[model samples]
Target: MGEADRIITLPAKLATALHGIAPGLITDTLAFANRFLPDPGGIGEQQMDGKNSETYLSNSLLARLTDEAAEANNEIG
Candidate 1:
């Protein structure tokens, strides 16, 4: 499964940590993106084109630091 699928299947706590993307909503978005009808918004189009989201996430330094912290937590605990 891809990232979306993984996110969709995650438990509530992890999903919350992943920006409050409830499992149901993520699964629904994936389903909508794959359906035959035209998408209500540009979501499917953006997914198809694989463009970056307009909602900028974090600067490279911050993201790297976060990743490193997660990795350390996983390894140590």
Candidate 2:
């Protein structure tokens, strides 16, 4: 079968557990981001604001990583 046609079922108990924890996990992660990486939309904004060489490098690396991930996803999907 094609990947797109594949179906996998998860246990109902596991699905319920995931649903219960997902919101708080997401909220805590966002709270961490807000605590550490505050006031900047993304790498592009930080780079645009003349943050530092580190930010420029990070932006470039993130762009390359994003491109690579897209290519890999296209290959898989």
Q: Against the true structure, whose TM-score is highest?
A: 2
Lowest summed lDDT across 10 adjacent residues in model 1 is found at 47-56
lDDT of 1 at 76: 25
lDDT of 2 at 68: 80
lDDT by residue (tens digit), candidate 1, 1-77: 64555555457546556545466787787688789654355574344432243323444564668658768888523
Q: How close is each model in CA RMSD to the real structure? A: 12.5, 10.2
Candidate 1: which pairs clash?
none
lDDT tens digits, residue span 1-77, model 2: 75423435556455445656796875676688788764545465434533233445556865677658768888424
Question: lDDT at 46 for candidate 2?
Answer: 38
**Residue-pair clashes per candidate:** 0, 0
Candidate 1 to truth, TM? 0.23
Instruction: Name the candidate that leads on lDDT.
Output: 2
Worst 10 residues of 2 by lDDT: 45-54
